[model samples]
Structure formats: structure tokens, C-alpha cells
Target: MTETRRSEIPPTTDPRPDQQSPAASFPSADGLRFRPLAAADVEAWLELVVRIAAFEKAPWHAQRSELEAAFSDAVNPVAENSVAGVDADGGLRAFGRVVKNPGGDKAYVLGGVDPAWQRHGVGSAVLAWQEARAAERFAADGQPGARARNYVEEDNPALRALLAGAGYSVVRYFSEMLRPLVDVTAVPVPAGISIVPWTAELSEAVRLAHNEAFADHWGSEPRTAEQWAVQMTHEHLRLDLSTVAIDEAGGDVAGYQLATVDPDVEARHGRREGYTELLGVRRAWRGRGIAPAILTDAMVRFAAAGLDHAALDVDTENPSGALGLYERMGYRAQRRSMAWDKPL
Candidate 1:
């Protein structure tokens, strides 16, 4: 079967026993096989991840090197879990990951399946493997089952249905919203606040600022400079687009906003897309309208980049009513992702 022909792919779901059995042929003759991926599968995995994201119209831009960095980190997590699904051909076909929630013991993560392999047990298989891995880890260390969870944008019924059938239930939802650059005007920083270019010299400050801002947000975790460095290695990174708000008086990172654009992605997405990857204000700086101020700065940066819109994601259950804050800034929900979890 050709890569584009999914008609021969397995059924929408397959319940693999808790353990694998010996079979020369696939359990179901749909020409699908499930196995773990190795370092050699990096390039294939990258292609599949991009294809799957495009299929769902999700926003992401990553190169091969970025995938490698992420996979390397997977073996050693800064704060997340991951899994992969390989076919009989020994090629990667699907992937999923769960991030450790700093606020709780759960993993809130994201996943995707190759379109051509949809309903072929690729996504289901990947998730099942992830669950088993978690289970084994617990068995070895004697820790409680770390509940594995994720979210699906409400509009993605296909993904929602698949996950639900696999024993994952929606526990929370969030919207990914965007604001037109034209609707924003750059405003001067308030007293005690200043904007500066994010650079290697200021890496420590940037890390501290983000850690502080996300401290109380959902899925909070202890992030170190190493984690930040791994993220920086992402092929999609553009330091110029990432900006930080500094408190010159205290010489501390009070607030920050990181943004990036990809020409390759622009070609695929039609219009250039910019991400509000990270936006945060220190606890002490909260309620001072600092987040909005930093947002305005981000809009200014986006507009200057000749982009028309900028996007950011938020958990609907944030303690600070962050969704309301985004709405006040003119962001409307573009997509709602749902989360599903099963005992590991």
C-alpha cells in the first residue's frame, strides 16, 4: 500500500493486550504494525509530526534537529513524558507526549497522528505504549500511577472520538486565541517597567521571569536553565522575536513575552503566523496591568515583523482568570483542546 492510501490501515481502534504476543503477521491484516522508535527514526518522525500537525491545522514549526532535541529530552525529561508508534516497516508513524504538571502529579500533554494512517491504530497504539511505559516505571519504583492526560480542541471531533474510545476522557478545555496586529497600538512601558532584547547574556533573567510568571498557572513545574536551553535549541527559535520586560529598579525579570515566526510555516499556512509562546509577569508584578503591558509590547513586535496576527494558548482553569484577561485584550477562542487520561 502507498503511504497516501490509508484505506488499508487498521480499524479505528484495536485493543492490544497488556502485553505483546508473537505473530508473524499483524494481529489485524490491515498492514499496520506497532513498535517503539529508535534514534534512527528521527527524520521519519519529523516528517510525520509535521504532516499530522498540518492535518489538524494545528500551529507548530519544527525541524529535524528540534525533534532530536525533544526526543533526547524525552529519555530525560525536564518535566514531560512521550511515546512513539512505529509500523512494521520500522518507520515512525505516530507520536504523543504528556508533560508533568507542576501544580499536580498529572501529565497534561499533546499528541497527533499521521493523516494517511488515521484510524489505523497508530495514535491509539502510541498512547497505549505510553501508558504501559508509565505503568512499568511505577512498578519498578513503586510510585503511584501517574495519571496520563491531554487536551483536544473542541472542534477536533475525530481526535476526541478516538481518544475517548481509547479510555481517555475530557477533563478540561482551553481556547487558542489570536488578535490582529492592526487592532493593537504599541504603548510605552509604565513606571518601573522596561523592555529589553532577550540574549545569551540575559538568559538567566529570562528563565527566572518565565518561571515566576508560570509559577501559579496550571501545570506549574520547576524549570531550570538546562530546560530553557533545550527549548532554545528548537529549530523554530528566533531570539529577536522573544522579548522580556525587566524591572530596572530591582534588576529582576518582572515580565516577559516570547514570539517566533517561520517562513517555511508561512508558506504552508499562507499568512505568516506568530506565536505568543510565553507571556508572564512575576507574582509581585501581578495586578499592575503588567501582563497587558507586555502583551501590547508583543503586538508591537508582531506588527513590526510584518505579520497580521499573533496567537497564544491558555488553560481555561487558570487561577488568575487568564482567559478573561485575553478577552479583554481582544483575543477570542480559535480552538478548544480537550484532555483525556487513563491509569498508567
Candidate 2:
């Protein structure tokens, strides 16, 4: 993700009928109304998301369950941290949300205008609401050096220009890498380590290991137990295809490769693809080839499960040299995305 700087801004309250509307700032919005999204809007939200995904050719789209989970997130409740734009008929036209990280140093801005509503000033209004809300969150938390961040696909020049105009700058680049699940090779597990299938009992241990493993990575924060629990039970997670490496002597998690399969993606792409959602090895076990071993094991299992490809995203400047490692393992960058940040 690219980082950008932001100037101080006034805080805004949640957009409700009785309060100042986010769309009111954009006179050209043509009577669009704004308010916090509620549970009843889930289906409409998914429809809007799918439309945006197709228009942008995004790598993935949100599933209904994912949206439900987001609404239930304790740190970023949908009804409080989200804004949705609707027309006279109450159809969702645009949406935005600010999600504060557990570490309180970053608030992720996510949302987009529907393809049908582009260029009518809706995008700008949505972004304005998101930035103001993110700033409000930062002020409330009293965190030093906090910033608002957004990710945009490299192919999306319109959004990139909008972010730039809003004072956001690209701070980092990420690649979505893909490798065919053919002729997968097995890498030897490190000595004194055992590759085991992911289990319900090992979920917490792996989550703890993951937090430590990524502590030094850019923009990463430890996942709270609640957040980890949500991820562990996500509808797309494929337990049978995931693997965790255990230290034989300590009986602790050394590393893990969590895999997932998005049925929607498979249907749209016409190929079953396995996504390596999270892969990490604890710092103490870094140089023992544990990462590669578990990754190889996951790939082999994916192929055995009849998957056509394996994919994962990696930060281009990862502290752990992850980009080079994935390259060596036969993955190629399919596309790039930028992370933009604005200081709060």
C-alpha cells in the first residue's frame, strides 16, 4: 500500500436524517441521501459491491457472509463506521467505511461508487465522509502518527487521480501472484518440525504465531482474538487445504499456511483457484525453510483437490523477502495494487 499525507480536518458526525448529510457537501450529487448502513442493507450492499468489482476487474468481491461478519466486527461496526448513499427509491448508489486498525495507527478506507453513479460527484463525497470519519477515529484514540489508508488497483486511474487530488500518496505496492497447481513439488519440512493439518484446536496457536511472525512487517498489527476468531470461521476458509507447522520439541506453532476457496471467484473465472490467504513463520524459526515447506504442502494439497491455480498477495518491499521467495516458487505477478495513505 502506498502512503500519503493528510492535513488536519474537522470531524463529522454520522450521516443521519437529522444530521448533516455527507452528500450535502457535494451540491452536484442531485439529491442523493446518506446514512449509516444497517443489517437490512446487506443484500443491496452485496449487489453494489459486485457491480463495482466487475467494473474495476477487482481480484475478489465480498460474499454475503463476509459483509455480515463486517457488520458484526466490534472494532468497526457497520452501523457506526459506514456511510451509504441512496436515491429517492432507497437504492444503494455509493458506500464508504473507515476501519481503525487494532494498533490504532491506521484506519483503512474502503468503499466505492456504483458504476452507474460515477462522475456525478458521489465518489468525492463518499471519500470526504471516509476521511473525516477516519480523522475523527484517530482523534478519539489519541494515537500518534495515525493515518488513513486506501488500496486501489493499478488499472484504476480515475480512483488514483481522485485519491491524489484528495492529498493521498502511494506509499507501497503489492502484487497478486499466481502459480498453476501443476506438477507441484514437495519441499522437505525443517528438521524438528512437523507439518500438520489445520485444526480447530490449533487455530488460536496459529493466530498467536501469525501476530509475532508479522510484527516487523509494514503496516501490520496484531490481530485481536475476536478478529482471529472471525477469520478462522470465515465461510471461504478451506481447512482441509490449510496446513500448520509445529515445532516438534516445543509443540508450538512454528508456521502456518491458511488456504481459502471463493466459490464466487471460481464461478466467475471458470477455474477452481486456491488462495493462500495467510502465510507466516515465527521470527525464531525464520531461516529454517519452514515457510517454504508449509507453502509447498498447501500447493500440493490444492492440486490434489483439483484446483487449477494457487494465488496470494505479497508486499513488494516485505521485510522478510517474501516477494523473492514467491517468485522462486514459480509465482508471477498477475497485477499490482497501490496503498495510499493520508496522515490524520
Candidate 3:
């Protein structure tokens, strides 16, 4: 089937077990067959993800609903750019997709492999496929200096070696920080600024503030309206636990913290943790303590909602000095994910 037509069919919620297998319908290398991913492959894709996460001792963050939505996103077109590897039993072993950035300046190469399949050529083959696809997409857009980026957990030796062998180099590091909510103190808002609960009406303003705030950040780009809306209305979003700081004098957004609660995490860990998905202070508001104040407000709100902890991810080299601020605010780095880039 053609790439554009592959994702036309709706996904199957319940993919059949591998025990009842179907004959290979695609090409093979190293005894593994490959095919373009379809919307119907979401279930199998998730199964492979769960297996990989279990072996890695981490929780899988992408939900089934999110993957399904992504497969159906007309703009992103992940299903069109993705490929999956299947083992002899017709079970999914690895999957990868290269997604072009909003402005078509770059593309993100994201993928996962079943633990048993790692180091067995599955990852290498998928990486090659993703890079080729990334180059094709970038060339189509006439983007120059096209770079393919991917993130791997800091401790994954096999995957790290695979990427390094493929000429990918470490370009960035991201830390996952966690802070206990017990006895947390909320900072008083600075004079002439107010912290207000986030509302749908403020999404666009907040999006603009986010773009402006992160403009100087490395590898950052202004999000398109569709990307911003998807993030704000994401399934895991907890609007009540989120807050935005407003400049009382001009009534414009000064800073904001958007939070989310993962039901899968709560169910698995028996504890709730509020995630600060986006936290930013506009350029004019920086150095005035707006970011910290809004973050403190988010922590207080999370605590009030009975959440035991709050979490956020930060780039180690953030131009805004966010790492030190988070540390001083009682957050500790729990783990890290490292970004790798390969020029195509």
C-alpha cells in the first residue's frame, strides 16, 4: 500500500495474539520482516512499548488514546512516516517514526524496541529507515542542515551504543526532577502580578508566552496552533492544577505552568504525581521571580488536590538557569534522558 493510504483505516483496539500468525506481507532482512505502520497497529505497537518499558524499569508515558490520536493527526502523519519490525511469530519487535518539526527545520526520530530484540539488528535497521525517511521529509520541505534527533534514557547501554555506532552524537541532556509536596511553601506573588487558575480562554496567550519564553532555548521552535491546542487539551491535562501568572497592569500573561496527571502512573504506583508539562516566564518577566512564583503556586495547588509529589523535566543547558532554580525549589533529579542527533 502507498504511504498516504496506509493510515486510512481506523486502528484495531484489540490486535490478535501472535500465536495465531499471518504470513509475511513485506520485505525481510536478518530474518525480520518490515512494513509501514498502520493505524490498526496501535495495539501491537503499545504491546511492544510495554515490554520495552518493563525491561527498562520505567513507566510507559504514551497512552493508547494518545498514540491513536497521533496516528490520526493529519498534520503530523506519524503513520505515514513510521515503520515496524515483526518477528517470525508476527509479533512487533521494534518501531520508529521520524516526525518533522513544526516549521520543517528539523525532525525528531523516536522509537522503541522489545528488549529481546535489541542488539539483534532490529534497532539498527529501524534507525536507518528513520534517518532515510527524515532526509526525505526535510528535503521535501527544502529545509537546510536537516538534523534527526532522538532521546534515549541515560542508562540504556545497548541503545546508546547503537546510536553512537550509527554516527549519532550526544547533543543534549534532560533531567527528570521530582519534589515532594509535603510542607511545600508557595511564594507570594510579586506586587502587581496575580496568579490565576488556567482557563481555556487563556490557552492562546499562554502559547504565545511559551514561544516567546523559549525562543532562546536550544533546539526550540514556536509551536503551530494545532500543536499548542493538542498539548493544552491533551488527555492527561489537569487544568484545575495548572496556573498562569498575569501582569496586573497590562493584563497579559507573564508566566504559566501547565500540569498533567497520568492515570496509568497512579494506578501502577498507588500514588499521584502532578507533572509540570510546560513552565515558562516571558522575556520581560524574567529575573522578576515570576517563574518560581508560578511554579510554587502549582505545587500548592497540586498539594491541595492530594497529590504527594510534583515533577518536571528540564534541559541541563537551559539558557534561563532553570536547573538551579528547580534545585533550590526542592526538586531533585531522579533520572535523565539524553538527546542524540545525526545530520542527514
lDDT of 2 at 151: 83
Would you give me the overall lDDT of model 1?
A: 0.61
Range of the 10 consecutive residues with the lowest summed lDDT in candidate 2: 1-10
Q: Which of 1 and 3 is ahead in lDDT?
A: 3
Q: List, residue by residue over 81-151, the lDDT tens digit for candidate 3.
A: 67788778988888877666534556777788888766677777778777777776666666778788877
TM-score of each: 0.80, 0.90, 0.86
lDDT of 1 by residue, 167-255 (tens): 78766666677777776855568788888888888888777766666666554554565566666665556678777778879888887
Poorly placed runs, candidate 1 (over 4 Å): 1-30, 61-63, 74-91, 95-104, 107-112
How much lDDT does each candidate structure score?
Answer: 0.61, 0.78, 0.73
TM-score for candidate 2, residues paired by index: 0.90
Q: What is the lDDT of residue 287 in candidate 1?
A: 78
Point out where model 2 deviates above 4 Å. 1-28, 144-146
Tens digit per residue, CA lDDT, model 2, 253-282:
988888888877676777788988888888
Model 1 lowest lDDT segment of ten: 1-10
* Better-scoring candidate (lDDT), 1 or 2: 2
Give the number of the best model, judged by lDDT: 2
Instruction: Give every collision pair in model 1.
Output: 102-219, 102-220, 150-339, 151-338, 151-339, 152-337, 152-338, 153-336, 153-337, 154-336
Q: Rank the candidates by lDDT, best first.
A: 2, 3, 1
